[model samples]
Target: MAETRVKSFVLRFLLAQPLTYWKLLKYIDVDIPTVQKTLKNLLRNKILEYKNNLFYLTSKGREEAKDLGISVFNSAMCPECHGKTVTLSPFKWLVKEFESLTFERPKAISEYDQGYVDSTDTVARVIFMYQLGDIEGKNIILLGDDDLTSLALLASGFPKQVTVLEIDQRILNFIEKKAALKGWNNLEVIRYDVREPLPDQFKGKYDVFLTDPVETIGGLRLFLSRCVEALKGEGSIGYFGLTHLEASRQKWWNIQKDILEMGFTITDIVRGFHTYLLERDDILNLELKVVKEAPVEIKIPEVDFYTSNLFRIYAVNSPQPLVRGKVDWQRELYYDQEAYVTCP
Candidate 1:
């Protein structure tokens, strides 16, 4: 059972050292209730004890884990990033490649268009896809590439073809220029909106699709539906980012249901995988407005704080096709008052 396996993993980690509930939630991608239930069960069985704001395995828990063997921790490893938010070894090459590329940073568009994560995270995203065997001669499409992930993917010299569909003309043009300069002939860009049905020629043409979608139910559904339309049948994989800061558990459940109903099975979720920088021009000013009381001068954030967990879903059956035609980009798809706050 998934629940049993999760509890065992937590026990194994406790064998090494006590962990706070917050760290467990932030690093482990399992549902909150599931984690809580597992902790409760372990406590009830006298296999775990809590003290000093940490959870530790009791003597019985240690004995049970010994019976299970130390190797059990292996299964607990995050399938997406391969380790628990641990940066990959040999990652410097990816970082170097990312740093070499240059582009102008655009102002965040009133919470309608979320800003991209730093280049390192963009490169890391591509690397994770590659590590999962989703690259090399596969047709990959980015439903949205505000992060310029396509560049990193192409720079890695994997994937037979890479396509980017973006609504922002500025991003489209920038990608086009950089691609040409790099002589990435296999890379292509088109000005397209996710609210619109996927172009006929693009449908059922990709082995993988990647995006960081708007978190609302309608928004996530529309974006994911378009990506599913563009994927080749079973075994096709899609990757995207979702965050707890914006999406509640109920919203996640609805989105997961939509994915399964459309014929996908979520394979892996790496929590806090993508980190976004909060530059003054990007999000610092916007975030300051949302607080109840505004300070005269807000100091810049030292750390890159905003983050989203990565989800990898595989097409378990033929992708359900939606009617092919233009669909209006309703305000509900991009703007939900509950999900966003912007200064007038």
Candidate 2:
């Protein structure tokens, strides 16, 4: 469904204008058969309506076209659709992915999301992987993300192999079926506990690694140590740090200092924020820590939003442009790949 991101554009275009199938076929560079088939499916589902050889959305379809994801878009900025209204989706929406979990009917999506907690630190850690030195075709091991494990793997568009290490057999078994449902091929899930230790086959065998192990300060260092041990000589690592549980930000700072001691250089430390919160929380100010002494530059293009919240980290084990000085992705901060000396 996510193939090429073409569907969204196609659907949105068609909904905005009522044109005949033939006209649309010739106007859009898409396959006629594909467009026709999609039209039929959407029409049948009342997602669209057509008459007089021209297409138009039914009332239900019109409502569906108005859907948007929760983001930092300021309604005030968009003079067209701006309002502080809440009604558990008092109006029905055409899109339905959040399903029983969309929180449309919750106390406050933004606030509840802010107040609601993620038991596992899955999404946070995966976002950190992109900032690592070219995560492309790298092997990944996610300890326990449940459904989130798969989404993160695909979103990266990199990583040669992603091994989901889980503690529960039932969840691990369930992931197989879930992967099939999603039609993802490059991801694999492993049932294992971080408490034991990474197996011999995993030692020093990966380029980059990430994990959102069960949160508890007592065992966190141990979990991170295993992640670092798995990386190559200069490989980097990233993970989520849930700050709500603790009053002190020492865990985040101490870990950065300790990781550098072990040899991994620290780069970007993106802050974490609520995807959907119960009330208005400053998304920008949410980023409460120094995520990076300098930005990390990878061969791939990237987008990072979590750098706007409570302290979380994305540190690396190598020395180069990261330690020498400030980083600018479009321009080199240093010439030598091995040293972080200031560039002319």
Candidate 3:
């Protein structure tokens, strides 16, 4: 059943033009392993062909697409906003400063599953939080700082305090050095892992929390449980990113159920709200199934095709954490069968 749906989606999308593996991953709403398997099946069946580092329909595939009634349509996104519904025009100055400050930022490493959104998207996230009254004078905590959202929040001159809890020593040192150079006394970086219990000082101390959690069910639960433990109480807010490339609809349903169980009422979910700028070098270094199994040698992607939906949830009641004191979940926390991009 899942294979049928993925085949239909791939055939319809390829009806318009040839696409690279990265573009297919961006457009398809299935898990990475599923997409890779489906593509291999299609090629074996002579329904698709690979050439010039792109995948397109074969003659038989076009006949199948016609039988499936697939038709091309124009995109309906706002050109100015790129479908984000918000722009950085209001904070152009901050965008320039953020660019300079992050010019020498550390490159993303696949070991920690680290990738960051574009500079505009980073500031746009800050703008969105500010509009929601979650920025100015709010005590906010970021479970991880690979995106350097902490810097954007501090640069906005909002937020009474911003704290970062990260496992990567490189990220911790980078953020701390930046904070000191800018004299951002309100910023704090803590070298902490998520598998452990939430620190006593941070529990119930923040008005808002943000994290881009790993997409596995266990990963999501652990990350959000920590965020829940950090909130001040009812009315506190949290933000995070979820992507279809890694998580399927069934997984999304389970995640939504977990959020409700944790006493969070989802306020808004903006689809494709964040676009990640994955470095080419970083991607080439990883062991991606799609690249390894492609019929033709896949070229490194030139476009920023990876994206995620941004979700905002409010703590309507006292937050309940599913995992209080963590048991050992080393590889399970980061890797699962659905995890195609993450290294084991």
Top lDDT prediction, candidate number? 3
**Tens-place lDDT digits, model 3, residues 1-344:** 77788888888778888888788878776777777788889999999999888898999999998898876534567888777677788889989878877888888877778888888898888888988888999999999989999999988899999999998888889888888999999988899889889989999999999999997999999999999999999999999999887787889999999999999999999888889887776666677654565545778887777789999999989999998986688888888777766776
Per-candidate local distance difference test: 0.73, 0.42, 0.86
Question: How do the predictions measure up, each by TM-score?
Answer: 0.71, 0.44, 0.93
Q: What is candidate 1's lDDT per residue for 1-344, written digit by digit as tens? A: 64676676786677778776545544454544455566667878888887766777888888888887753343455665544354655677867866677456454455555567877778778777877899888999998887888888888888899999998888888888888988889988999977677888898999999988887778888888888899999999999998764565667889889889889999998877787654445444665332222111223443454568899999999987433456676667765543532232
Lowest-scoring 10 consecutive residues by lDDT in candidate 3? 287-296
> Which regions of candidate 3 deviate over 4 angstroms?
1-5, 293-297
Q: What is the lDDT of residue 105 in candidate 3?
A: 85
User: Per-residue CA lDDT of candidate 2, range 28-147, in tens?
Assistant: 433223444565566677866666656666666656556632122122322321111112232222113223222232232221112322312233334334434445777766555443
Looking at model 1, which ten-residue stretch has the lowest summed lDDT?
A: 289-298
Top-TM-score candidate index:
3
| Model 1: residues with Cα > 4 Å off, grouped in runs | 1-87, 103-111, 281-290, 293-302, 321-324, 341-344
